[model samples]
Target: MTTTKALLIGQRRRLALTMVGGFAGVVALALAVAVVADLADIRTATALTDRLVPLLVFYAPAPIAAAGAYARCGGPACLTVGVVPALVFATLVVAGTVFGVPGVGGGDAPLGGVTMSFALVGLSGAFVGYCAGVTAALLADLAGFGGDGGDGGDGETDAAE
Candidate 1:
């Protein structure tokens, strides 16, 4: 009986999926920031990075991460959903800004001074998405949407058996 219950994901699994998505988004955003930073000429790269990296990071990755989590984890959600993204964001910040990866991550000094603007933004977005997904899933279950009704979406009916 492949019912809605079967389709429903556990809280732990949903959280895991959310974290995975968030990590993927954060990593992609970090790479983009680095690439963008390196796009400018030596004379203007620092200025461009200082102005652009933060915006790109703020606008791009957070949504991607949140969407991934929301789509996969339609459950009550968990702490990991937020923690993973935050950790990933913090790691990237430390690596890109603190380690001073020359020619990337904004480098040292005025070059790499933009990531801090939205360090928590990505995590917060993922958390919100996860929460929404959880609420949606719960409401669906409450509405009896999870029941098999002897007819799963796959077209297989209990009458056939």
Candidate 2:
């Protein structure tokens, strides 16, 4: 293949992977939020919405990374990007708690009180789901289970090898 053709092929692959990863991340985040609500006994829509605050807050950065992952690399890289933010947030919360920092709780106090803990856990769970989804998508892509791989057919492996 010519240099330009190769470059374009690589770019297309990266974009496709990133898009898949981003979509998976979004779905995973939604499911995770639902699960959190269910686990917290939020049966009603209003109750679920109320409980979803922290989760939504935590996932604010997820889309940016997901988009980037879909644009440059495959799901594995996308997951790494998504996970780093979650880990950082978790670490900060833990560190602050250890140092007796107040109001981290999402209130007048350092830890934000009970709400803070709930939010933290929700965020963490969403992040975990996002990472899992990205990894799963990447694996599926690599295994030729899903996604377009220039094969022009669904679920058909290219026998170019």
Candidate 3:
């Protein structure tokens, strides 16, 4: 009963499910921390520092989770798995910046700065996630987790002949 359509759907579903962890875990945590700090009127010694904390939190674990997800998939498909979630988060950040989310500390910066900062946050998250995914793939390859036993050597061998 298995069809190509069903298989593709299942694959897409798996990617979506994996991405939810990155979105819910890392991005949501960052948003919540920003909200809590705002509600509590918490301010660090420097306004810039206070504003940057959320961005830092948002980007920190994103790549790590992405790497883990890529490792789970065991191949190049992991790039999409890692990058998609990070891009999703970045899109949210850009939208929030454009719309002026209150108490996010993004509103006070100059338009250019705000745009640059949020854009960079998202872009950097994606870049880091991509790098992490590559590293994970390499490690997996080295460990012989998913391979035909060539292990990066020439295809020819005495046993094969």
Candidate 4:
């Protein structure tokens, strides 16, 4: 396959995997935290879990997707892909804070506090997920998992040549 095609595929796959894995990790972490703390009440844990799970998931793929896109498109696109999400997240957090949206981990808190917490959690999760994804994508690229290095004796390559 062409390098572009390979990169697109890799990016998409990496994004999907990163999202899934990150979400799963968040849920697992929340569960572990709840179990350890003996705060198994759904009301208490649910808010925290809800706030955290998506954030965990969102950031998980940022790096990987960026790397894959970079491998496919080169520096500018890679940088854009890597940076846009972070910018958006930051913007949202700022807006939410200015508007007094409660989004932090403390769902039991007031609306503004909760909004801030949620925003913080979501942004944090996305960042983390993105980092994980980028690292993984970079590693994969280094390992020659993505991109068209050369045809591996495929009949298509022979025909094209």
Candidate 5:
């Protein structure tokens, strides 16, 4: 059986696909949440907005980045795939603070607090992503996946390699 090795920079197509897929995954989730947030008729014990704000601001980006890092297993795609989702959520937080979004802007909190919170969230997302990437790389190494030195993990090594 022939083996295929994955490369970070040398292989263009697979890298592009993963990058696009990661970005799309983040966008799709944001759109889904937006659709849910826009509905006025839905009733729940807790306002969906109250629950979903945390989903958007904290839960979503970190996991997505982590998953991307895990999937990439050691590629730059880890950062590219992870950071977009993080920034998307971060942007929403900043906008919510500036525009007074209910359940999001924390109207009683000082603007400085909002800034610090968003900054923390954003940095945490990226840092967590990096850590995940590191973990994935270590895991790949343990699995004997990285000794090949051509690719990280997203599957399909370059034919030329």
Candidate 6:
């Protein structure tokens, strides 16, 4: 396959893994927090704004995991792989938030004031996650963690080497 096509395929796989892992993590975390908060009598579990904190927190890890997976592929395009997951997450979150909240607009427009604000918040969270994931991948590349540098774990060598 062409290089661009291969990269796209790799990115898609990374995104899928990120979504699956992220969803599982978020569910598990929500349940755990619910149990603990119930025992502790903390009302933040049901509070509207407070719940956003956990949502952002739980969502952060998925992109990091995706970046790690992408870094394993070991190429100059690792950052691109990291970014794909973040964009995917952001898009989904923004679309969901905007649609879930009902608003009456004169036109057929999708978002209203409150919903737009929520979408922005979700987008910011996704941006942070994306930056984090890309940073992790870049750091790994610099540290020679997953590059095709003949580390011998994969029993392969770069042709240029």
| Predicted structure with the largest TM-score when compared to the true one | 5
Q: Which model is ahead, 2 or 5, in terms of TM-score? A: 5
Which segments of candidate 1 are over 4 A away from where they belong? 1-22, 25-33, 36-86, 93-100, 103-119, 147-161
Q: Model 4, 1-161: lDDT tens per residue?
A: 45444433332333444544454454455544543334445676676766664544345335544443444333233323333333344444465567665452223445555445544544454445444545554667679874355442222232334
For residue 60, what is the lDDT in candidate 1? Answer: 45
The whole-model lDDT of each prediction reads: 0.47, 0.44, 0.46, 0.45, 0.52, 0.43
For residues 8-58, could you state the per-residue lDDT of candidate 3 as single tens digits? 222233444565455446555555555566656677524544665555545
Look at candidate 3 and tell me the lDDT of residue 56.
Answer: 51
lDDT of 2 by residue, 60-83 (tens): 435543443323233344344434
- 96, model 1: CA deviation in Å? 5.1
Tens-digit lDDT track of model 1 for 23-126: 55755565555555565445476565656555544444444434433333323233234344344545654675666755434345442233333445655665
Comparing candidate 2 with candidate 6, which one achieves the higher TM-score?
A: 6
Per-model RMSD to reference: 8.0, 11.4, 10.4, 9.9, 6.3, 8.8
Supply the global lDDT for candidate 1. 0.47
- Compared with the true structure, what per-residue lDDT tens digits does model 6 show for residues 1-161? 22222223333344445554565455445544554555466786646435653454445444543454343432223333323333444444465456662221123444344345444554455445544555564566668773433322345333443
- Candidate 6 C-alpha RMSD relative to the actual structure: 8.8
**How many residue pairs clash (N, CA or C atoms closer than 3 angstroms) in each of the candidate models, in the order given?**
0, 14, 0, 27, 3, 0
- Point out the higher-scoring one by TM-score: 3 or 4: 3
Segments in model 5 whose C-alpha atoms lie over 4 Å from true places: 1-41, 73-76, 81-120, 143-155
Off by over 4 Å in 6: 1-111, 147-161
Tell me the TM-score of each prediction against the true structure: 0.43, 0.30, 0.43, 0.30, 0.48, 0.37
The prediction achieving the highest lDDT against the true structure is 5
Candidate 3 — which residues are off by over 4 angstroms?
1-13, 24-26, 41-62, 65-69, 72-106, 147-161
lDDT pick, better of 1 and 4? 1
| lDDT score for residue 66 of model 4 | 45
